[model samples]
Target: MYWIKLSKIYFHGFVAAMGVIAVQGCVLSTDLPDYKATLPKMADSWSSQLEYEVERSSIVSVSQTWFTPDFHQRISGFIVEGIKNNPELKSARARLEQQIAQYEVSESAFFPKIDLSGDGSRTKSSSKGPDGERIKSYENSFKAEARISWEIDVWGRLESESQASYSSLLQRQRDVEFAQLSVATRIVLQWIELIALEKQLDIARQEKSNLTEIVERTQDRYQQGVGSILDLRLVETDLANADSTLTSKVNEHSQAVRKLELILGRYPSGKIQSAKEFPKIVTDFSAGIPSDLLVNRPDLLIAEQKVIAAHHNLNAAKANRLPRLSLTQSTSYQNRKLSDLFDPYSLVTSIAGNIIQPLYDGGQRRAVVAQNKAIEDETIAEYVNTALKAFDEVENYLGNEIHLKKQEEELSRAALMAEQGQNLSRQKYYSGLIPILDLLQAQQRFFVSKSRLINIQKQRLLSRVNLYLALGGHNTPLQKIMQTDPEFSEDNRNL
Candidate 1:
């Protein structure tokens, strides 16, 4: 009964000791700044707040869809291939894996480390005893030990480090997402450019054909003594200019195809096939608000993650200023006879605990704390700047979308009028009612107007692409953003 009572008392003592150690563990506290409240407010709705109407007959809503049917199979295939094979994206994925490994490394600090070691030796010695006798001895010794050591995270330093690594991993994940978005955007825009160039080539060939007909007519009139040599020369000059423009367009088209091929991670053979016409894209974009960008844009997400990591790192640095506690336990066996090495009588066991508090380190610990705090502040500033930049991009693209559409409309009307004027002048010239110069001027105006119209159409498509990118590329709807992850939603709420 007395032994049972003694055992109970010992158990209570062990429990009390553990309680004291747990209470002594560092309780980390942080003055995490509230940067979310400082984020500036943006317009409530892009359409209502903008200077012009974003909705037009041609403008289609892109809130639900990213790529329209007009993109075609080939362009979509190229974008997918680019995302899968792009070296930059592969590198980003590797970096994310590295961060994951680092996170696991930090997590290991929470557990104890055990080691087993053994040694054996043989020795021969000579000894003198009682100043008259000599003795010889041979000895063999064997030792084996198992030890375990652990640092009790009294101040939450290890926990903070693990959190920092997790945040870094998330940041890298956002980086990969951003890289993917960027790659896809480039592919889409380049595909559009290639199509526009093809159209320009067709337009140039038509203009050349028209100039060739005029040149033949001028030659015939000159031969019949009805047109002056000066008129024939002017016509020939116009034909030459048309031919030159056609050649330039062909070269440009070749260069564009090669550039797109390179982007697709293929050889620049200048043989890429593309759509003959520019695909119509959705022009209208609904930029929800600035706060929405906090969840939508990958770059902004990365910045926010950085701020979180910095906060954790600063906390860790502060925690480093406290005392550390370590516990060690070891069991061993040693015997002079090899056969007796495992005997119960040869066994030994010991346990020890240590507490180390920094006395002086040439102010190194304080310096680290200061540096981490400064880094935290820098990250906060960057986060704010990134948020502001995202808002500015949305605004710029919103305004450009409106203006480019208006410009496209005006240019289309001008092109129609120029075509009519050219047809009327040709008829009058054939009836000898107008001079060759008048006919040439009308043709030139029609050609220029058509070319300008095509150029503006290309710009409008590009603006739509820019608008898509500015609004965080493809999936910017609140529902989609929220579905990314619970942590993402939490982070957005924090923002």
Candidate 2:
């Protein structure tokens, strides 16, 4: 009786505490450590490590109108189409919804669970009395019961588990965002490549036409006895080579068109035509500080979420070794007649609290703690490696931007000179003042120079694309708001 009375008092106190918590709507009063505090130190600025002067006036993020605003706008339609149809992006969104559902499931643990049950039984029996007379008896019974069970979170274990689930949800959210960015980047690259292939095909067709005309002239000269048989053979060989080159270029152009159509989530019918011209390039942009990577990059944010989840998992594992307190209440009604089941005399009620302390579990709890710690370590390492690789990518693309520009300029001059030399050699060969070999060499040089020029120009554009991707596209409006609003910042997210 004394123990029952003591339990009642303790239960009342617990109920009062729970009432206050229910009003507050929080599982724990204290906050966990912020993820930023756990990050490794990084350089203050990106330019310090770069060889060239980077315009540091603004952080270079993915912008709608990037290095080539005109080109970006032109491709915006394609990007929109791809994002809508991309299977990977769709899958990421579905995973995000799945994570949201899972988080809700974890949160349900914080509330009481109630169950109801009903049962009815009927029996008939007959027996013989000691006096040899037959006796018969009939019996009927019914029961209805309701039970409520709640686990008290005295050690914040439930809170930690919920937090872990929430972190995973956030990770999934970031994945969706990352998928969108990736789809955009890929579409841009494939579009640029298609244009380059188209240009190359044009060059190949022109070369084939020029070689065909030369072959006709050589045949006429040879028939008129003004050119050697050897010269006619050379022209024929050149024409054949040009035909082969044109065929290869046509195949490449077709394949490029098909690849692009696929990226846009369309049928690869090899019929889509890319714009013959490239958009104007604008190269003056800034690479923001390295710290922005933590804020702007989705993969890094996902990594941070992983770390947060691992931390909570370790906490929950440790809590498993501690005592767990749970309360169960059951109310039941029983009677021979169904109508009298709920009668005051037939009613019974009971409430009990149980505290289970782990006696032994073959070191399972300790092993779980150790395992979570290892996972935490792995996430940290991966985060660091990802950051380093991001840094490297940014640096490499920036350097390529400079190098490719120089290459295009030099190749442009080389192509121009080669064109002049080839023209002069052809004229001299027609006048019989230059050997066939000299004319052939000049033509070869001209073709190679023009091809290189086209290729280098494409590379320059692609380098800029890569640079924008590496910089981690521009911050969204919500991110901008978060930057200015203290309440939305990562540090205050717990509140």
Candidate 3:
């Protein structure tokens, strides 16, 4: 009786402690970590990262422009269609489906299990008296019953296992989200690269055409009495240079086409057309604060979920060593004949209590417990590291944007002056005021400066895209609101 009283008191204490722990779970994580808080400020304020914020854009609303129906191409839906067709994401989603099925296997233990059973036998027996000959007898019997068993989950052991399984399922769902996000980001970047290459091809073709005209004029001058043999040689040199540049651009343009086709999940053939202009990029991305980033990023959320699952696993391992209490019961009917198998006249009932404690296992259970704990610790460390790395990316982009903006302004002025200089030199040469070398020098400088300007513009646009992605909103208004508010108010951010 005294021992019974002690056991009751012990269980009560445990239940009380668990209730306290459940409440603490909510309160302990209210504050964001230092690294998470510093990200937005490091990237500059809301206006700083808002370089590409287009006025007509809506973060939540989809524009009809992104999914216009083409008569020839069956493609529709920018991201949704991309995710549907993406093989990696499809594979991940299939895996998640498989994992969701596994949860059923673990959950089955929580409910009663039933088994049908039967037994039949025929026996020959011999009996003998102390002084008499042995006598023989025959006996036959048949019995059938339905057996049922259930392990009553006490001490939350079964609940803990279910929680662990749920965590695993959740982790896989996040993996699916991660895969989708990855494919979407790749498609966007590859598409952007393809467009940039097309523009470059145009630049190359334009330069070649201009150079051809210059070469032709020089040839006409050389053929006249006033021009030298050196002038004719210079024309030949310029023509060859233009051909070489055009060849390089053609090769690059071909490569970009192949890459874009591959991103759409197609096999690359030599066929390519620069006919399609790129979709207007989303410039205005409102990236929320650093803490908000943690919620928006699928990769980080998946990582955190994995750590949470590992934590549950470690707890499960620890629980395994404790004595588990379960109640098993079965009610059935037995009969000597098949017809009587269901008759309640021969009903039988049994209830059993099981107390299982791990006495010895060659330290295997202990090792498992220790290993799981170590794994949980490592995951926690990794979660912290990933969070820090995200912070660095946001900060780097912010700093780059500020500096690149200034550089773009200066380079624009430089390109304009170079253009003017090139025009003047061309006019002077026609009047024989400048030598062929002076015009060639000016010609090279003018194109090079113009190319540099184009290159910088491309970089700035790419920076906007990358910054938007890294900040986790991809040129959406929710991102800006998150940045300005620094609080994750967007309903979609969590998901």
Scored by Cα lDDT, where does model 1 land?
0.80
TM-score of each: 0.84, 0.86, 0.74
Q: List the residue pairs that clash in candidate 3.
A: 52-283, 52-284, 53-284, 285-475, 286-479, 286-480, 287-479, 288-482, 288-483
TM-score, ranked from best to worst: 2, 1, 3
> Which stretches of candidate 1 lie above 4 Å from their native place?
1-31, 47-49, 52-61, 65-68, 72-74, 124-138, 282-285, 337-339, 474-495
Candidate 3 lDDT over residue span 439-485, tens digit each: 87887888888777767766765665566567665334323322233
- Please report, in order, the local distance difference test score of every candidate based on alpha carbons: 0.80, 0.78, 0.65
Error of 1 at 311 (Å): 0.5
lDDT by residue (tens digit), candidate 2, 249-346: 88888888888777778888988768898766744555677888777888888888888888888778777767688999999999999988999999
